[model samples]
Target: MEVIAAVAAGAIASACQNAVLSSWLVSICPQRDYAKELGERLSRNAHIYTPGSDNFAAATTRWSAAHAPEAKLVVIPSIENDVAETVKYANELGMPYLAVNGGHGAIKTVGKMKNGIQIWMHQLNGVELSEDETQAKIGGGAKTKAVTDALWAAGKQTVTGLCECTSILGPGLGGGHGVLQGRYGLVSDQFVSMNIVLADGSLRTIDESSDLWWAMKGAGHNFGIVTSVTSKIYDIIHRDWAYESFIFTGDKVEALYENINSHLPNGGSLPVDIMHYSFFFNNPEVDPNNPLIMFFIIQEGNMIVDPTYTKPFHDLNPIAVDGEGGVFTDLATWMGNANTSPPCKKAGLVNYRFPIDVESYNIPAQRQVYDLFASATKETPALNGSFFLFEGYSTQGVKAIPSESTAYPFRGDNLLISPVINYAAGADAEIDAKAVELGENLRRILHEGSGREEMHTYVNYAYGEETKQNMYGYEQWRQDKLLELKNKYDPERKFSFYAPIV
Candidate 1:
């Protein structure tokens, strides 16, 4: 290693809020003519940014401040080849590097990457429709809002994450869940081809023909950096959308969950046109002693949710009922995941999510978790902002794909549950440890209730404590395939910052 120059320190002084600049990790990397040296290898349009320098904030800003990486440099790739050049430059100097798109990944493993260079991909953003209109070529850095707006303008749509601020490939590569998944399958299922920069710094366009394509769909973070992707697109069939929300107090937990089970007996029987999202959040004003349960039943192609779904919940006598109707674009706003929504805000909050994929909600487990959550939040007022999420999306499209076809192994699971513990950043070590413990305990109740020996979790929302079998599948073949691919593609594990297979 070499000594860092005063110029880097000067930049850090200018941007005190940038985590990469504020951390002691800056001492680990040697200073060099990073801008001039790397710039020469990249295209003329490519630009390099250091802390407090030219759009550095845009490249460095993150949704959650928890377990974030410390970058010594931020390189913006104007084109696909620029990514390869940057990767090579980082490799030659023996520096760690990470790809930043939406900047929303907050897993604890990412914090392991120190004195690294962030290959900021925002400059590679755009979308182009093929002549046949059957597919769309999306830039790897493009956000969900961009793709949704672009496709909706062309009277088309595709499977994407629920949040507008998230990058298409950021979550897609993880087999991300979306409301339209019931119709088109998971985000990865829509992939046709992709331009990825492998660990060896080689850029190649791969598709179903490539042996690595199977791993790229799910667990892609471990293999390489995707620069661009061609994905299957669908015509906009239902322009209009409607949703009905039911809010209840703690007393109705059993009744509400039991009702849901009666409808989705096996967790995989949800209708393709419907999606349900529910959560428990603290609202002392509404229920001082407990969190309020908010349930959303969204329906496609209609201005009002059908009574078939809403009627049953209405019969339960929810404390409050609200409904909204609008076009497909309005769905995110209604669901509080729009670009401007609070959850989408880049607040300096430390968020830890303990996620699990279960066959169905256990009524007893739900009650226990709720009580535990209420008590924990009450004990620590700072954590009162936490929310327990239960995502119920139609599984027809997910299950329609062969279980062994892709790296995503939880297709059979019907529900996505997680306890998102949010608290102020810069908390003491004891506070952080307490948050982790509470999150784990909350998830444990549900896992025990499911009665599955192997806990299943969504890799995208992993808490970093889960085992390989928990995030991936438990089967020997799934583990063997992922391990084999990891060995072949990333021998040195350069891409191991986020949920490494090893």
Candidate 2:
């Protein structure tokens, strides 16, 4: 309430770009009232939407304390012209804005605004499936579940994020990774074309024909607001089944990772119908001494029996087994709480990433990470979080395209290794400090063994205060090009928010 004066005047300034058309939503409404308004809007449209303050607050809170709250005005622009009007107003007022789809961005703070516009992109949620069911035009706001359900109903398939709540375009823009990643390629690779509203408030279509499309691949959000995205869809070769394998504690973590790295590199044509993830949890109901660690594989339809897909891991003798027929979405739900993040009880987050190599097979390094996490679990008993490690599936499909095609720079790297430590929201400062300490310890152990340091960080998984350059890791030429694009297109820095380059 105290900040309403500035926010209101600012909103007025922005809406005036097309005074005849633009609608002005309040910049700062009471949190409770904001939720009611958002729910009402959703009730009416059921399709087009701008998220409420609760949604933004929940997302902001999920971020580390260093970047808790941003984006004052939530704008729902129905058409491309409306987006142009919104952008033009922000440009004239020199106010920053952030785009939101499913609000599933991993770089939670990146698109935040101090007190500017939050252009909620969910308003554009239409999907047009092709007659052959091999492709679709998905509005930028469509979530994975929306696309999956839509495509499934049409008896087609497209590689999508395994987590149902993740937005299709949001993740695809940054090189989407999912269960199908090992087969078809990262989601960005599936991009056929897209309609984008540029910083100048004009519309442009991007695809292989335009250099801008290449730039949009990995560097998308930096240029403009995306209205819709087109991607390849495949025939439904299989349905109503997802193969699952749960590798437990005695499976030998080191060997399991090694096997994964070896198997995921083959292109999809080689039988990569399986999606994989590993989990480490301490269940009071199970074991108090050693946390229960499990690995999961979800094979779509008949792909469950594909030897290359399940054989490598099945040989490991997983302790528990559930091989059944179910909807992929149902399988995701059965997995339980696929979307619960670490309660944001802290001020900072400490994360370290290194490239995965044969050294990851070392038992000492594996135990080192596990021991460090175990101690933290005991020390901060109130902190609720777990450490995770995953490798990038092969770039066969992603790399088949020229490197110059997109802003994603990690195509050259075979795998990505990440370790995380999350804690209660209010406990961020201490939690961050401890996580950093442990991260450094793990870094030293791994790097000393592997001889690599501070190399690259995954954009989707990066956290607070680490610079943007570190996450992108482009070559000198590409970095220069990005900076040039930032200056040329967004010269006023209206898009700069959390973890920004400008």
Q: Pick the candidate with the highest lDDT.
A: 1
- For candidate 1, list the clashing residue pairs, or say none: none
TM-score, one value per model: 0.93, 0.77
TM-score of 1: 0.93
> Over all chains combined, what TM-score does candidate 2 have?
0.77
At residue 464, candidate 2 shows an lDDT of 38
Q: Model 2 misses residue 402 by how many Å?
A: 2.9
lDDT of 2: 0.60
Q: In candidate 2, what residue range of length 10 has the lowest lDDT sum?
A: 350-359
Q: How well is each residue in 242-307 modelled by candidate 2, as lDDT tens digits?
A: 656564663367666667657644333324545555656666565665556666556666534456
For model 1, state the Cα shift of residue 28 in Å: 16
